[model samples]
Target: MTTARRGRPGYDLESLLQVAVKLFNERGYDGTSMEDLSRKLGITKSAIYHHVPSKEELLRLSVDRALDGLFEVAASTEQLDGRAIDRLEHLVRGSVLVLADRLPFVTLLLRVRGNTKVERSALARRREFDRLVTDLVKQAEAEGDVRPDIDPAVAARLLFGTVNSLIEWYRPRRGSSGAELADAVCKMAFDGLRA
Candidate 1:
């Protein structure tokens, strides 16, 4: 006969989500299974389900966490009230900080291939975020803070492409901080684009 099992102490939805996101990052979202999660967590599959109904729900939650951080930066007063170039710098800095702080989630967000409804939704939000940054680039160009030769959309794409690529290789070191990296990115990007 199977013994009655008690829930693990201190194990909650947030903790479960953390493990799920980490596993999803280490193993591709499509590659991980509930059994894998249960094995990693040392819990029964039913216990995993107690926190979230399905693996897809966990994916949605993980990508949403990354998207929420990006949206928060986009909605900040610094991003909205500053000169366009300053605002763009703030957005870039905020994005670097978010990626550093939430590397696993952001990495997963960047890797989503839109195979599922949640992935498609995440992709849509990413596109919307890109459009908002593109608008800032256009405004900066009009104000003569940024060079006019390149199209605003193209500039925005290149800027974000560089920033997003950080996840591939960035590992936090003892003295280095997100703000320092952000400063470097702004300096490099603006040095090239500033008029």
Candidate 2:
């Protein structure tokens, strides 16, 4: 009398987040709707509600996935005993690995424009991460490893901007591994910024 559940399997929160991030990246978060997600998922909007109360909660989860990984790297890299410049390099490499591993989530995070409470919270976290990098850059400058001519905040932005730019063109399956690409980034960026 009973048949097996076949077709598309039930989506867990993780799987739902993955598809949501992909759609958010493709259509921009502001443009995407619960209806669109329900259509794509072959599930009703009420089914999605079973996982999360609202679309904004979904955005918060997706962006938090990215911010959590990034903060983990920043925290671990800070604890390493070495020159500030070396620690910064480690942070960059770890961040690239995060981007490659969670490309879709990071992509969605990068596109956030603070249009909602969730987006504003994400932006606040992003600014906190940027401050961490800026502090490290200032440490490197104080150690005489970084150039004194540039503002540490500017240097931090430029270095991380190069890393973040990967979202525009870098694919996980591209010719280089994340570590390889990170090496190239550090080599090019640090070479120019070093005193």
Tens-digit per-residue lDDT, 103-160, candidate 2 = 8899888888888999999999999999989989999999999989999999999988
Q: Lowest-scoring 10 consecutive residues by lDDT in candidate 2?
A: 1-10
Off by over 4 Å in 1: 1-10, 77-79, 192-195
TM-score, prediction 1: 0.91
lDDT tens digits, residues 1-195, model 1? 012244455468988888888899898999999989887877888877878889999999999999999999999924367589889988998999999989888999999999999999999999999998999999899999999999999999999998999998998898999889888888888885465
Colliding residue pairs in candidate 2: none
Please report the candidate that would top TM-score against the real structure.
2
Whole-model Cα lDDT of every candidate shown, in order: 0.89, 0.89
Give the clash count for model 1.
0
Error of 2 at 70 (Å): 0.4
Per-prediction TM-score, please? 0.91, 0.92
Q: Clashing residue pairs in candidate 1, if any? A: none
For each candidate in turn, give its C-alpha RMSD to the true structure in angstroms.
2.7, 3.2
